[model samples]
Target: MIADGLNSKVFLAPMAGITDKPMRKLVHSFGAGNIVSEMVAINALSRRNAKTYRIADVRDEPYPVTVQLVGSEPKLFAESAKLVAELGAYSIDINMGCPVKKIVANKSGAYLMTEPKLAADIIKAVKQSIKLPVSVKFRKGWDHKSVNAVEFAKICQDSGADYLTIHGRTKSDMYSGNADWDIIAAVKQAVRIPVVGNGDIDSVYKAKEMIEYTKVDGVMIGRAALGRPWLIAQTHNYLENGLEPEETSITLIKQTMLEHISQLQKYYGEKMALALSRKYVCWYCKNLRNARKFREIYVKINNTEQAIAEIERFFAENGSDIDERS
Candidate 1:
């Protein structure tokens, strides 16, 4: 939704289980770009489902949040868009690029790339249902041979989408190999609306590279943001101004990790947070000294006290070491 209502061009992709409220809040605190909610199922939401309501909640949030909805039915998509609007959503994004097996099997997500008619209908319905700016997130095509992002982007614009986000790989390619920025450039040339490029953008320099190569309006970062909440903020500053990213030390990472765990606890309670923090701890300690040894022991600790202790112990052992991974 960058350049529509957002003040920044950098966007955090709507990653399920990764961009939830706790993670969004953490990234926003660091001045990250537009943050999107995990995909909310419109089919369930149209029935006034309680679980979907909880997933779409952005009420009274200090940072702007875009709600991404996924489903095949146009009426249901429209209804869910209206409902999310009532929940203080800053904007709405329709998910047409998800490549998960179950999602594509349901005729939603990347499957829509093969069925342009339904994709356009869903976009039109959602746009008509709310005043919020609407955007479409899709991929290169249903497969490598069926490249249709250029055509799909045009259809979305014709259907009244305010902007479009195109991932650089086909559904068949999944997340493997290199992202095809060539297809992204093609889509940008094929449309007048602002186009955001997404796929394997993991560093500030790479984000700049994609912009220069694709001539895109903006860049969306996904997997790279894991364990590095300040990436969006850093990328934003680098792009908006001629500024370099600040150095990050091991100590700051530990503090940030602790804060993230605290938020997860506040949101999901102690028990669930304990299980969730395990994976996050691994992400945070990805390449630290003896990280494998730490992770091997950390994932087994089922209690909060032990987890916190392990985090404290790991960082204490490696003080003031800056992240050299990137």
Candidate 2:
């Protein structure tokens, strides 16, 4: 059962450089309630880069889509929100959780969490600029020493955020250890607007616990969905029927990879698709028999045709069963 509310509970996180339109469509087709596009730099949107315009486009999806913008400047942030709304975004999501060095150095992303006041200002500017619903996604805080999700949630709400998504780990933790659901619960308690719990929800059991324990309005899964976008649909089914997800077969996994590659080729040209698919290619091959050998072969190929051929040959000749537990 999809969580009923102003916003559906299951959202796809805005993974920069990865979750393009093709991948976003695939995740949605698999049953994600809400999805965010890849993070776009606010500064880039303001300048109206042709490449950014292509990335910001969201005309294909039928469901409500939120475009995430990252930046610390108030005026530019406001302008960017207006532009995105004009581009037909259902909502605007401000990213304060990205831990990339480039974003932090620019006083954006997770670094904004260090100053709740400034974070609030950016939200305020965006809300004031656009009529669409505005939200914020952020880490626990800048680091463990400064962990304060509750305070940040309040700041965002007071400034005009319609909802909040809290990634359980602190900025300092990066992608290590476990994401603390305790703090996410605290944020829920501190704010009246819906709270979306994120981080470390890699399984159906964890998804149920995060919602039931943290009392969050929704949940967002990140890295866990790398080669397994179907996890979102599996989670939705688990919530609805209590049925375990069927284990993904080696054949189906290979087919999915091929389809994903084909979609990338359609959206981006052959060269760009080949380049972007490398990381995904590596991810899909993980833990399989002869994966090392496949990686050795796949990484060396430069053309899409060769890469596809290598993938088909490896799976047909040496693929092993994947343990698709949920």
Candidate 3:
């Protein structure tokens, strides 16, 4: 039940398509307690798919990165866990919390919450396949009528999970509604192993509030950090030092935006990175003056050079050294 190599108390939650290597690298650079990979489908990784393998690569990362695997079959989960272990992952996390319809329909993700036996089998299989610490991330249950996070927590512990993460919503809730911290608290109370609470945590204050309320070991932040990667480090510093985070300057924000695109270009190549940078720009420019108008022109951009120039021009026009949240 002891989780080693998980020394930090604030972590970045795994978001599909959003928590990629570039994003993970950026957040890690700012000092998060830990970061989890976007859910890598066990089926693809077990088959040695190039794209999936690339997603699972964390060997070169200088942080404790847990590679999260999602799929229905326990055998494929075992194979993928072993592959991730070989790739030097800090740990292997079985993703049973994702609520995407496609994932649920495949008898995976939140659907696993409906079948505790199968979920236990998956955890056992992955545990037996790798020497790394094992963790399970799951929701309260499939629906409100079926809330079982407390029971599920015990199952995860009995099946050999070193720790657990419980998002406060159910599969039916998806990402909507207020997350029920009561269930998260219940899960923490039920399990002897460490539990990290997730869902609806957007600020360092809320992160501290959730830990205090649920008594979970830590907090996992998701969408709230999309454009604000530094929030993770801010939360960490606040928790460890009780110091309030300083207001980030517009210049540094622009610099981070530039660095983000550069990292995207390095990992995904020029053309693809240009295309992908559109969403990132949208996230970064939120609430800024002319943000909507600028994004309209930005996403249509096709050339990498043009995209970089636009970023430079937009940031320059906004301001250089002040907080310009309009």
Candidate 4:
């Protein structure tokens, strides 16, 4: 069952630099059960860093806005969690699953998995500092040789974390190889609180399969939602009504791309929007007939109008009817 006040069981995972405000808004609009802000560093936030604060902004988005914070110091976690609660976050997620070398070097992210007592202390501090529901997202363990997710989950539960998200990979694996669902199932059985299974759930079938195989309370989609925000809605529909999703139409795809551009432009001004649109353009047009060529051209564009014009031209040349308004 979903947590109280949450609408669905599918969640959009917190991807740093990718799940920004515009992306979160788009995915939430597409009916993702919950959306998490990109992981913000507690040290930067406690220092009132402008860029960090900007990235953590969740004004006017959907309910249950979960702000994810990553850091090693328990005091900083407490301070940042209080700030996030004051900023109207519905929940606060401690990010212990990030596998980046830089993050781990700072004694944060998956590095905490190696120091379970420290991880538990941070969770307790954050939970004590805020009224918002506290959750922790972590990996299986430090490495393949030491898989400690079950022990870690128990530590988090005992420390007052209200929920847990487990990515079924060790820190050493990074994003390579297959995520061990058995590990996630083990975590679920070990913890009484809701456990969210994450990693490699790139399709609706995978989402359903993970839910059934692991008996997880939910599934968190990360890389899969890059271009296809509708996947969240489609997965929700499939799970709730047993409806299979059809291939998205070209017309709808173009419209979705246009809408994404519009939201980006509104959030970040035109110039920054144009720059940011390049990656998303590549994601949206990845399967098109001339995707490589389209990406080459998209990367060279310097303005929003030029980006929009190229998108229209590209789709029109590919035989899709243009909906300029979208």
TM-score of each: 0.97, 0.93, 0.97, 0.95
By TM-score, highest first, what's the ranking? Answer: 1, 3, 4, 2
Q: Can you list the residue pairs that collide in candidate 3?
A: none
Which tens-of-lDDT digit does each residue in 1-326 have in candidate 2? 22222345677788988888878877877764577889888787777888898787776667777899999999999988888877778888899998889889999999998877888889989989988888899989888899888888899989989889999988889888899999999999999888999989888788888999999888888787888888877776786678698877787678888888999999998988888888887888777777787888887899987898898888878765444333
Query: Per-residue alpha-carbon lDDT of model 4 for 1-326, expressed as tens digits?
Result: 54555567888999887888888888877764688889999889988999998877676665678899999999999988888777767788999988898999999999999898899899999988987788899999999899999999999999999889999999999999999999999999998999999989988889999999999999999988888888888888887788797777787678888998899999888988888888888887767777788899889988777888988898889845322211
Model 4 residue runs over 4 Å out of place are 320-326
How much lDDT does candidate 3 score?
0.88
Residue-wise lDDT of candidate 3 within 187-286, one digit each (tens)?
9988889999998988889999998999999889999888899989999898888969787677767888999999999999999898888998998888
For this target, which candidate reaches the highest TM-score against the unseen true structure?
A: 1
Clashing pairs in 1: none
Instruction: Show the lowest summed lDDT stretch of 10 residues, model 2.
Output: 1-10
- How do all the candidates rank in terms of lDDT, highest first? 1, 3, 4, 2
Off by over 4 Å in 2: 1-7, 319-326
37-71, model 1: which lDDT tens digit per residue?
99998888877788778889899688889999998
State the C-alpha lDDT per candidate.
0.89, 0.83, 0.88, 0.86
Better of 3 and 4 by TM-score: 3
Over 4 Å off in model 1, which ranges? 320-323
Candidate number with greatest lDDT: 1
At residue 40, candidate 1 shows an lDDT of: 94
